[model samples]
Target: DCSLAAEQLKNSPRHKAYLEGVSLRQLQKLYSLLKGHLGGESLAESLENDKELAKRKSIMDELFEKNRKKKDDPDFIYDIEVEFPQDEQLESCGWDAESGEEI
Candidate 1:
């Protein structure tokens, strides 16, 4: 019922402003974290049997927990710009290359 909780929070008078101040990308990330928390489609299977998925989920959870900020937090910035350093050469994708034929 994560979605339900989110809906309730969104509609709550006390939290409505805080949610409104949050960006769509932040909300999406929250949704992703919540979905991961729910164990996704592998809920029926034991996490021990799906070590890879569990590991990925663990990493995601750690990252989200480490980086998450509340809308009301004094240090919370509405916008943030982060540049990731690329040490390796970029690979070109087929979809990114233009077809020679004109439309």
Candidate 2:
């Protein structure tokens, strides 16, 4: 959704930059949170079958979906915008200076 909002703001120099920055920070935070979780195991599991911990982990996974995507494009993995050269009009239009399309 954020990526779509950014697209709508692309025509406005100020708003586009602002939204891009905010979305970028969101991405960074999401990355750090996922990295932390992926690199470690559950801190505690009070449930004998670990059901609670499993549920907690699943919720976290859904929040960002580190491996979530459509057609394996790197951009769809997040709420950030993506650019494909052939789909753009301007010279290098797909390449937004603020964020890489291939990201």
Q: Provide the TM-score for each candidate, comma-separated.
A: 0.29, 0.20
Residue range 1-103, candidate 2, lDDT tens digits:
4344345555467666555556554544444444445756333322222575678889998876765677668565456688767765765564465764443
Best by lDDT: 1
Model number with the top TM-score: 1
Q: Give Cα distance to truth, residue 100, candidate 1, Å.
A: 14
Cα deviation of 29 in candidate 2 (Å)?
0.2
lDDT by residue (44-81, candidate 1, tens digit) is: 34333457777999999999988899898899998799
lDDT, model 2: 0.55
lDDT of each: 0.70, 0.55
User: Candidate 2: worst 10 consecutive residues by lDDT?
Assistant: 41-50
